[model samples]
Target chain A: MADRPPVRDWATDFDHTDPTWVADPYPIWDELRQACPVAHSDRYGGAWLPTRHADVAAIAYDTDDFTSRSVVVTEYRPPNLAPRGIAPPITSDPPFHQGARRMLLPLMSPQVIAKWEPSTREYCQSLVHELAGREVVDAATEYAQHIPVRVIARMLGFPEDDADRFRGFVHHVLEDVTLPLELRLPGMQELFEYLRDQVKDHIDNPRDDLTTALLNADMGGEVADLSHVGGTIALLLLAGIDTTWSAIGASIWHLASHPEDRDRLVKEPDLLPTAVEEFLRAYAPVTMARLVKHDMDWHGCPMKEDDWILLSFPAANRDPEFFVDPDEVIIDRTDNRHAAFGLGIHRCAGSHLARMELRVALEVFLDAFPVFHLDDPAAVKWSAGQVRGPRTLPVHIG
Target chain B: MVKIAIDSERCEGHGRCYSLAPKLVEPDDLGNGRVIGDGTVPADQEDNARQAEGNCPERAVLLEET
Candidate 1:
């Protein structure tokens, strides 16, 4: 992470990487929603943060005004890579977006994702089993972090032991966005190199996994190109890891702190599904970004072409206008039309897979511990960037 | 009596409708919501149908009273 000045005013100068925003951003977002619904910053070369659900949704849906050329706010603005940007679908726009997205949607749909549940559950159970006799456990590292890495690795047919390298890739792409182009570009290059190697391996072996599926994926009667395959693989690997990892870690962190929710869930196991949704709504892990297509007045904020729009679904989920008692985490709360996964075209392709991982991880953890709490409240450290969650979560299970 | 319909144009496959009311709606190959069996909601399952309609983030789920 790069060092920078602390945020003076969240409304005028909001930096997502700022310690104030990273530590506890809900209050900052709450204040911004009322005072400045769309906050602007000179950091990251003129970025705008839209705190309202309507604004964020409008931006997400308006493919015409905001381009998905680059979803990450970094010093280096990726050259116009629309339709099939650095990562397809997630970074693609309009007609091109739908096709690229459709190719992968079936692979992640509920029915398809359902088949992985058994394996995911087994993996989670094994993780829990490892921590059986431990009095204190780092859920983030030991339990929550490993689940997604293992699952995604198996799906991609990559070496499962290379989890550390994947985390390094995640940190560079997501957490280290504030770094200079010289530093950031190399990390991205390394990631692509890794994907290329994996793609080569899949080609040689032709195994049953996402890499093979993507390589052989049809693009309107034409096979997807090499770069597209590698990019899509990059998307699957990078997107799948930290986002779900954060969701699982945050959910466990919540349970560790809030025994009431934990006990309720432990007693009535059926409530886990609803509670999972609630956790996603309240502590939604992913916040996406978009680049302004043309200079235009956006809700009184003078936005320039190529200005970064932090399309914060997290902020949108907490918008009082959209959610009842927006800040409160009600386990069984229905009518939760939250934009946790996002809205419109670019809804997380791996949402079903993520949901499965989260539900299973929580289920295994609660079943193993039954009763747990934060070992040290002050010790929990949240990762600073778009994907926010506790990186180091210490809990006492005994 | 009520019948359910999903606007394909609006449905982005969030799976909320199908998740909430599986009997009334189900996900297609692409995970978009599809009304099951003539899209009709039984008297007993009307609440589930309505819940699905209201909870759809895209507002794609439609319930028509007949």
Candidate 2:
């Protein structure tokens, strides 16, 4: 066999099996990004890394050249996912992809997202208020975790009571990386069944929510069928809930660590918008993967078909070439153009909704508890892989 | 002075501009484009408005010199 690319020992130890890497993989990320910006790994069975910011951004936007098929990490790839992998619409190349995006675009219009802002703000305030006067509280469990799931539940026309249930299901899918295939398959089935039933209910009643919208959405003069609805819901749940939770938690962690930035925002409340952008750039919560559609050269590397290319959003956000002093959390950093929400066709559909939730969450929390501080930084925990964020952020609010 | 205006017809309702520059742009109750602050175009916010235009995924926002 030809010489294999050097694999990091940590990749073998942690790869997809180890739970330790989920806790805090930044050190490993730094090492990989520095040592091999385009390194391949044996543990992942020939997965290519694009650690630099520009490379990741280029690959993410170049859906025509570097397709989104098989976007899931090797660790998270399910057998059934392959059939739908990189297919038309979401995973497909342009022309069709453009139309698909357009079809779904109306559902996430600013007005629709803005209507949910009140609910999002109320939820965030309640979570923060519940933890008030307490020395320690799990910020992730109480705050970050609630926003996206709750918003999604409302959008999907599911009862607010189902938020915890759906959150549990999503958590199982994301965290249970090491579970047997048999066990893992059931989780997907359970979530699919739940969503399927939810869609059926919408079809029967036909409310004015997102489920209803999707069910009625005409894709070339035909309503979205079960599979399309199911896939869209799954995509929204995964993208809307988990990614937002990670970003909210990560933002809190960054604010806690950088008291100066936090204090500055609190002092000048007008800077909250800029502060939001800075937080997104400073701690992007998602790492993306795309499959090379056909054999094409990328940066002197012969990226072949089906080659899994990873996009490091956080790394790209911090690239000095893109942002000056990218490491610093300058709340009012002008000329900030980070790919936190990504770019091009596959750019997040729910980004506007996500931003509304984030901005409102930050605004409410800062206004409500300007003097809050972390009870213990060490108590905060993190999870990695496709989604990265604090597991628990303990804080004291007076 | 330069100001940004969102084309409601071509907006596609993506909301990228609103997210990028919420201070100057907001959606109505139905999520249609609505300029914040009576379209005055605050002096300090010109840059944000321009950035929103440049970053708009749909190119729905238009900047006009006054």
Candidate 3:
């Protein structure tokens, strides 16, 4: 009989599913970057992890071959889900994706995002006012979670009363990939239905918000994929809340632990925007993925079709080649160009909005509960690796 | 007289140009950048305009002296 080739083991060596690795991924990523820049694992049907900044940038830039059909390293997708793509431009490839993004991009343009600042500040102030007298605040739920949801809620034309439920849906699809498929399936179903109804509602009613704007968007000679619009809203709900929430929560956590940085910000309020960029650099919140369409050797690692590759923006932000003293949070850090919000065509459409929220979030929290410290930094529980941040941030505010 | 023009294809609307040289760079509704007033970059603000051009990640912003 002819000799058979040994089966390749994908899950060997790298284990992102491990809690220890998830808790502190920097070390794991560093180890991988040094030993194997293009690390592979069998976790999600043979996934690839690119730890270096330059390699990550190259893959993101080359959407021609390495497409974005699956934007998550671990696929929590339900059976019979459309093979085309899920979240509009994020999961879509070019031409189609380009038209879709151009159609939706104007809605989040800098001026439009800037216009929301007053209202975002208003929302932050109200939350601060409510937490004024409290010496203890669950900064995660109380402060961080509220800011973006309110802004997103306003954008979606959803009622404030529905915030908790929608957030639950967001958490379900985006965060709870670890949950059993049966448990996660219902939430996914509900989320799909909700977005579809919203799109339908806008098509009929046409209100004055993102939904209406997306509906009225000219597709620039391309046929409008209503499902793509629905997927865009779905993407908005899933993406909108947690990413900014994590950044805000993690920023406060950093400041609380490092009093000097906290006080520096309080004294030099003008440096808030600069500091916000640094905050994003130090504690970037998202790590998105791309699906391998064709067999290609990337950074010498053979990536097969159907394999998933994670572009760890967080790890990229900390690459020594990219940033000076990448670990330390240097407020007012200049010449800083970190890709907290992914790079290339799929670069975060909500970058401006996320930045505005972070600036206001920290400013409001500092004003409301000054001189706060983590009651037990050890007790801080992070979200399951996908959308990274504190699930419960307990702080003592004075 | 100097002028500013954006390689609309290259510009991803990072908005750094707007933040740096707001007087010259105007952000469209999608946040993609555009040069205001016939893409003219006045001589005095030329440095500021250059700064914007330099800062663009995509190098979409351009300076032209005509």
Candidate 4:
């Protein structure tokens, strides 16, 4: 008998995709949370809006109740790309999801990640050293972008020379929306083809690398085939490159804007690890989605099946309920159980590897250049959608 | 006197600690190591532990006084 509240239309032209919103969606997210943490959206074809931390976390881990298969926006899938609608396994519920995750877990283990630290650290240091005497340099393009792609390329046993090309392909695949479907499809096709060829080579050679590992991995009863290898590669490339790139740029931006925090880090380098956790909590790069499997009551709101829910981890990390003084970046703040890497079954598989890269990179940067500052904070540009990061960070090093 | 402890639940078996301080840590069949032997803190070994901790990809190992 009660009139329904006005639905939040997220897919409209007037939606929160404006330049300012793209740069920072937290204020808009905060507003949405206050208005209706579980409001429906007409634009997303009547998907539920879960803006609060607790609501998002609950949905993310409740695999039985909220499944991943139905969460992906089938309508949003660009034409010419492979069908992402074949849910139930890649985006499936329980048992199936658990099996896939368990199979891929070994590839992301701490031992596998540790082997790449030296190279990751070296790559970061080399980038810094290259810009040592320069008065101004694009931190995002030069350092953040370079480190992760290279590390990923090496892990997959791709040649170092292919790093730049692969980076370009990934950037276009994920970022270039202006291009026609004709162009986009080819880009996706090229990437998939390249991966397929590499996977084939690795399968034939059986090298002791990630590509080979994925090729050879037994998904228990099901053997990982080319499509499986392709999917895994695509996941790693997108995750390894985009997430770390965003975090590094965001971390540097935060440090540059807050000189006092930088000074504290310089004074006490021991806080780098904790600082990394805090940074991740503050600036999580990934925004995940989940789908309600059955009609259920959440936070007193009735929700139907097949409703898409977006979990904004950044918003959750800054939730006052879980973090004390969540807005302020407390470098040494321990007890950080932030879900920057989403919790439970679908948690970021590369979290340890990401931590090692971030820690080593920050450590080497602080050690090598103690008194550097941003050349022009205003010039820092940010990428939009799914992943967020400074497009360019020009810094002046001493 | 001092000792080292590794929480297996937390450990991803990175083996970086053993690589850093072989004398103090040894790896099991799964490459996960336990701190079984005494770690002689020769004045400079503090730096080694610090590096080991810093280099540890997983925050699995804890060094404490016995």
Candidate 5:
């Protein structure tokens, strides 16, 4: 983790990587939403956080004002690689983003995701089987973490045994935000090198996986080159894993802590879908960033060119202006228009997959062990930085 | 009778409408919500269709009376 100064005031000197914010950001965001909806921070080279749903949604939809060239706020800003930024679609702007995203949308559609459900459920059951006899299970590491890693690994045609390596790469990109460029560059380099090797393997021996599909993907009659293929692969691997993992881990953490919710879920299995949406609404794991296109006044804040906008869907989901009792978790909340999967053009491509995984993972776990609680609430450590969730969750299954 | 419609321009494919009202809406090839049977909401499914319209984050799902 980057050793930086602690936040003195959330409105002016807010840092998402700050210890206070990472520990639990709901309180910080709630405070900011009431006091300052658009909080500015000098850190990360002049970053802005829009805590309200309207502001975040406006930024997400306004492609002319903000560029998606770099969604992650790091020390080194990516050079203008518009149309096909560092990672196409997610990092690409407007006209190009749609085409780049369209290539992968069908692959992660509800129907495609449904096909993976049976296997995903089987995988979850196997994981539960492995942790059955254990009295104390670190659900985050033992179960939740492994689920998405395995699923994405299979999709990318990468060796599933390299799950730990993927986690290391994900940590470097998402969590290690405060690290200096020189230090952070190597981990990112290693990830690309690994991806290159996998692409090479797929080229040598074509298979029916996403990697192969990308290599042979057609972009408006033109085939994607190695760099485009590799960048898309990088996006899929990084974006797909940690986000869903956090959702699953956070849901498990919620159940472990709240016996009533857990009991209700166990008794009314049909309520899992509704409960899953509520969990997503309350504990949205992903917070995307965008760079300002030019100098402009946004909601009274004078934002400059290249300024980072920390578009927080989680904060928006909890805004009192949008939701009733935003802080409280209502498992049966039906009228939920939460932006957990985000809104506007850049809605999460893998949302359906993430939802399916969360539902299946929870269903399998609850069925296996209906009675479970936190082993040590103090021991639950959340990941620092943009994607927040319990990294080390100790649950007492027995 | 009530009818449901999804404006493609506004539907970013959150699929909330389809998830909340499966009988009334379904996701297309790209996962954007599409109304079932010319979007004519059965009398029995009016409540669900309305629920979906209210729950859409984009407010893309429109409830029309025929």
Candidate 6:
């Protein structure tokens, strides 16, 4: 057995699971960036938290040293997990990652996703219409979460009948960060089983969905088993469902707290695209992990093999080294290279789709309830871990 | 006479070039952009095309005027 590195004291010890960090990570992030750019955390069996944009971008680009093979920032590894790994592209590196990505690329491509834009517009508008009679709506639960799951499900060619179930599976795996990975493994296993059945069905029946496209793809070669396909679909669901909603929820949260911005958006609707970009940057959603492949000196910190390092895209967005006013949310901020969806080879495959969803969602939302505000500011609840956003936001929808 | 070009390798698919100057930059199937047509930037749309070049995150787009 390979010996684990001895634990050492560090300047900044971030406990991601802690509620304090979950609620408002910016203060701690600032402390770490100023004091310890490469701070270590003892929570997930000693993980490193990098608060600098350059360091995070370098690590992402240096796939050779910091691999995506084991992205979860924990020492926990299940014996039953496949040697090929949990999810393709996201979990894969180089040759394998490239091939797998090519196969999945068209699903979210401009032409393909453009075909779904009308329906996407319809979905967002319809959801807003449904909330017309409500006095107070939990905008996060009511609005932000509605459109993405259905759109992703339809795009993947999954039966619309089970879209709710699909959302349930996503919440179980991604949002259920209240418990450790050990406890969450059971739910993960269940999701894998469900995805496995879905992939098997696609293989046997041969539908005209994204699954069929992936099933018959010539990706330099082929996956040995259908389980790999199942893994890939599972990965999509994991990546797809929660991420955009977090941004959407955070957008509502931001607008609710800052009515001036909301009023401006309502008055000058043309600014929606720029507002979306700023929202993506200011409340950048996803934080990804990369495993240290070899024991080496990273910047000033002595990183060891198998140690986890969180490349906080949110933190990177606020990196004072790059942006002029890192903390302030400038809606029309140009020259913005924020890593909201991340960077490097494994940048979000569904980014175009995500951008479209956010734009349409906000556009319809502003049009539908231009005068809405948070009913109880104190009651807004946020979800922490991997994907972060407002889980519960009660708004007075006029 | 001039044509625009982009080194696709550097494209992180920011889509700014296309969004800013759609006449010059066209998005490929997955929304990663490329210079449209023989990559020609017409005289009327030259300023829009230049803005796109300035805004691309990866500096992928290139414009040459002769």
Worst 10 residues of 3 chain B by lDDT: B50-59
Q: What docking grade does candidate 5 earn? A: high
TM-score of chain A of each: 0.98, 0.89, 0.93, 0.87, 0.98, 0.93
Error of 1 at B15 (Å): 0.6
Give me the displacement of residue B8 in model 3, in angstroms: 3.9
Model 6's chain A TM-score stands at 0.93
Where's the lowest-lDDT run of ten residues in candidate 2 chain A?
Answer: A79-88
Stretches of candidate 4 off by over 4 Å are: A1-16, A44-46, A70-92, A176-184, A294-306, B1-66
iRMSD (1 decimal) for each model? 0.8, 4.6, 2.1, 7.1, 0.8, 2.3
| TM-scores, each model vs. reference | 0.98, 0.84, 0.89, 0.78, 0.98, 0.91
Question: Roughly what TM-score does model 1 have, to 2 decimal places?
Answer: 0.98
What does candidate 2 score on TM? 0.84
Model 6, residue pairs in steric clash: A109-B30, A110-B29, A110-B30
Fnat across every predicted model, in order: 0.68, 0.11, 0.34, 0.00, 0.82, 0.32
Angstrom error of the Cα, residue A197, model 5: value is 1.3
Candidate 5: which stretches are off by over 4 Å?
Answer: none
DockQ, candidate no. 4: 0.08
The best candidate in terms of DockQ? 5
Report clash pairs, candidate 3: A10-A41, A10-A42, A11-A42, A106-B30, A109-B30, A109-B31, B2-B41, B3-B41
* TM-score-sorted candidate list, best first: 1, 5, 6, 3, 2, 4
Every candidate's CA RMSD: 1.0, 5.0, 5.0, 6.9, 1.1, 3.9
DockQ of each: 0.81, 0.21, 0.43, 0.08, 0.84, 0.46
Candidate 2 per-residue lDDT, tens place, A171-220, comes to: 77655644556667887788888888888888789998888888778776
Instruction: Return the clash pairs for model 5, or none.
Output: none
Worst 10 residues of 4 chain A by lDDT: A79-88
Q: Using alpha carbons, what is the TM-score of model 6?
A: 0.91
Of the pair 3 and 6, which is ahead by TM-score?
6
DockQ for candidate 1: 0.81
TM-score of 4: 0.78
